[model samples]
Target: MARKGGELEAFIAFLGGLLAAGLAALAMAGIGLAVRPTPALKSAALVTLGAIWLTVTTTVYLRIKPRSS
Candidate 1:
């Protein structure tokens, strides 16, 4: 059954995105700390993580949101 898009759906998507992005960021931080990654590597990682977060969040939000007729 198709569900109507509303505040609840948006909230769920936001929450899911946060969880996914947060975990990934934590993992990257852990690895960076453990290995003492180079500055260049660190910069790259930050950029990558930012991209991942944005992409995941936007994608989730869009996917969860129903299109208007």
Candidate 2:
């Protein structure tokens, strides 16, 4: 039977987006770190920000799930 999308799917999507963003940030960090010492700070900042966002995303997902029957 077909099923309507639910919070789980939303959570999964949110996680995927977070992961993609983190990967992009990491790549940028690598490139930046390669360029100059100043960019290294930006690199660390972005990676940390991305990790924080990922943690928030997971927390939100836990909040969204309803109690199981």
**Against the true structure, whose TM-score is highest?**
1
Alpha-carbon RMSD of each model? 3.2, 5.9
Please give the RMSD of candidate 1 to the true structure: 3.2
TM-score of 1: 0.67
Per-residue CA lDDT of model 2 for 1-69, tens digit only, reads 555556675677588658767777787668776776475777777777677677767666666655454
Every candidate's lDDT: 0.80, 0.69
TM-score between model 2 and native: 0.47
Residue pairs with backbone overlap in model 1: none
TM-score for all models, in order of appearance: 0.67, 0.47
Q: How many clashing pairs does model 2 include? A: 0
1-69 per-residue lDDT for model 1 (tens digits)? 767657877777777777877898899888877897898997888788777777877888888777887
